[model samples]
Target: MGRNTRKRRSPLATKVIAGAAALAVGGGGLVWANFYASAHESGPSHNRTRSAGAQVATIQCPDVGQKLRKVPRGARAGVDRELAQLDKQITEAYARLASTRQAQSGDASYVQNAILGPLKSKRTAALDRIGTNIRRVGGNTPQGLGRFAECRGMGVDQPDDGNGNAGNGQDGQNGDGQGEDDGQGQNGGQGQDGGQNQGDNGNGAAGPFAEDFVDINDVQPGSRDLENGFAANGEGGSQGSFTAVCGVNENNLFNSDNLIVAPGVDNGAHHTHDYVGNQDNDAFSSDEDLANAETSCQNQGDRSTYYWPVLRLQDGTQEFDAGDLGGGAEGNVGKILKASEAEIKFVGNQRSDVVAMPKFLRIITGDAKAFTNGVANANSSFSCTGFEDRQVTDKYVLCPEGSQVVRTSNFQSCWDGQNIDSANHRDHVAFVQQDGSCPNGFQAIPQLQVRLVYDVPAPTVENGQVQNPYAVDGFPEQLHKPITDHNDFINVMDENLMNEVVDCINSGEDCQ
Candidate 1:
């Protein structure tokens, strides 16, 4: 983990070093810093040899130290405008890069020429302009400008370390990936104590799943309570419902490119995921495939792919392992244990009037990038088997002896009823209202909730010392930290099953 003591060369410097031996000295005694040496120099009369070593040219960035001073009021607006333009340019550049794919030639020349090359050049130019504008507004610092340039010039598809820590090339200001400064407080910044027991309305005991334990109070109030079955006549007048169990598809368990987060980059997920049900589920899996793929579900027609980050447990020596499930490879940082059972339940909309979700509908719940942003976007909940009243939001829970640990995720259920997919992957669907009714323009559909139960053993203790506790894989360092785990589902249900589900909801029958 120690920093390398050798002097690090810039990318250009390395290239220069590789070609240094071929440069030639001019008649004026100045060495030409070119990759090729003139052939005429080989003539006997002109064969006077000169050392090929040339000092690497150091590109000097503008000195902006003095620019970080008092500025005129009018300059602020110009600076803001320029910064916004730069941000827009950077975002578009990333989008274009994401659309580029590898060719069959077994070479990445297309990616280099069409993506990374242009991206780096554009980013460098933007950073330079930004630096100049910041200085013009009297708000530039040498260190700040250097960091901005470095991060912006780095390639766009860099991966996170999976420990909630942003890797190099990430803008330090929004390294957590929320990418917006909406003034929401930092996660875990306010509450420190584990037993503070902050409750809904900021009073009384914490609700189930401990809504007060984090800042997710506004995410959707009933998610915790809804873990239990919804009442028959509770909201929008009870509708019919049925639960179909989609078993695990072991061969489909993958660590492929993730289109939701870092799109276009191959294997960008970094962490592995356990996928079930759908046979053709991947970053590039198409609507056509979803409609046709055979499924592992008993219904055979429900081909929806259910996926989540694999869970790993810490062993006796405090090292995390993935057990039998294949993960924690590449740059991933932990081990994992396979869930004994994974269940995907589809609950009919409380509104007895909603229709069926269209085929190939994509639904994403919870923010995968929410780990560092705090628990607001994290929709994960945990509880013990018998002591269900003690549901908590903490990453790792120490269950009592003879108890089982459970992780649950309930996805958004309301749909726009038009588009099967959206550019952002979320605009097509919305959450059901607090009163259990779908929003005006959105239609209510079956809600998908996944539950994984683990019979984790309590940490062994001897002589007042605690041994290994249960830990999930892929996070860096501390095995027990809370994670921003989320889930994604693309409805590949058979047309018949879909029709049946729609009928059940419209009929108000709660059948499992």
Candidate 2:
């Protein structure tokens, strides 16, 4: 996150925005998931949206971790803890902002004076501690940490969504909540309801708004040039793939802690994760503990931990974690949706032969904070079972009667040879260049790809309300935007097994 992230445009998706009509169905409402104010604003500022009664959407703070270039090994743990606290602070601030919508609509200075100001004070202290932690460990403190203390309110002028909050101006539509022509014409009366029933606590804690979903048919087909350079190479290349038969989280190993990014912090993720592979993983799971834990993989040698935010059907079913912090308590209410199949596999890079990855190499694909942090790191893909050719990165795919929902996460396959992990947890590894070659000084490693298939009942939009929708658990501030969906992995394969997997790829053998 500290490093300069390269922007690479691929043939992954034709367009990331929802087709207008795709969101107007049954007055299902619109989701301004990408409409937040800039995070680069110096301090708290009014958005001056379409109306003076504009409401706050989500909190936007400079991502402190993403700005960090490095933290000495001795200071990494403390710095990580501080970074997690920063995220925690944002989550709490956003929750407060969400709950106080009525107040936000009335007083213009309310958010700046109350929410943003207090949040800044708290973040300032945390950033100071991070600097102290670095200096205490004989590491130079990174500059500009203090400048990130200020955050701003991100929102749009919103119609009073009958979802609960009041004083938010008024509904834009007239009669029937049906058809009414305007700037974009009828829109069938469906429009941004300023995020549906955000505080409902039935389907979700905050969101997964009606507009967050789109008809799979509405998405344009995305294309990818699937050249792996194996055939083009005259000399050598790793063309084969390896599969890890790690079942989905059938064991219900769930938690809201992120061991890689937020070690030692409980509920650091602020959302639940469905874990497979390592049986013992939580805020306190040390590398040693993970190494000794039983695994769900068929080949016991693959003890690596694989996890992602748990998908939940907003069916009002009370799950075990209904009262827990990372679960329903934090607005992630719903029936937990277990993936029917979790296809965990490692595939080779395209341009060159791959080298064995260091044991315990951690890679985080996609971005859990992509909702507010922007889509620079977002790579989550969604498609229906049969319509795999058509995928969308922002909208949840609604399948037909018999078709199932599918999620695909492709991890970075390039590694910086030296570090097993980096301060940012991402800088040590990178996605391949647009031409299928690793960046200079980076080597190819087995890229992990996970396909999670779910047999979820199609969520329907009826009379402006979406029913039984499924959304990945996420920070309340993120509003369950599909772009925030992500996957995490830590390489724990035994040295012998790692060597064997490398051999399988280099020898052009796709083996289990």
User: Given candidate 2, what's the lDDT at residue 244?
Assistant: 94
lDDT of 2 at 496: 91
| Cand. 2 Cα-lDDT | 0.69
**lDDT of prediction 1:** 0.44
Q: What's the distance in Å from true for residue 262, model 2?
A: 0.6
Q: Give the per-residue lDDT digits (tens) of candidate 1, residues 378-404.
A: 566766666554444443555666777
| Alpha-carbon deviation at 390 in model 2, angstroms | 1.1
Cα lDDT tens digits for candidate 2, 1-512: 01001222222122211121122212222222222211111111211223122244567577788888889999988998999889878876765665554454455466677788889999999999999999998998897789989876443222212232322222232111122222222212112343334323363225665556777877666542222221122234677879999898767777788888898887778888888898877778788988998999999999999999988887767676655556655567677888999998787766678899998889998888776576667787889999988877777888988999999888888899999888888899987876778889899998888999999988876433467788998877777878788999999999999998998888889999
Model 1 Cα displacement at 208 (Å)?
Answer: 23
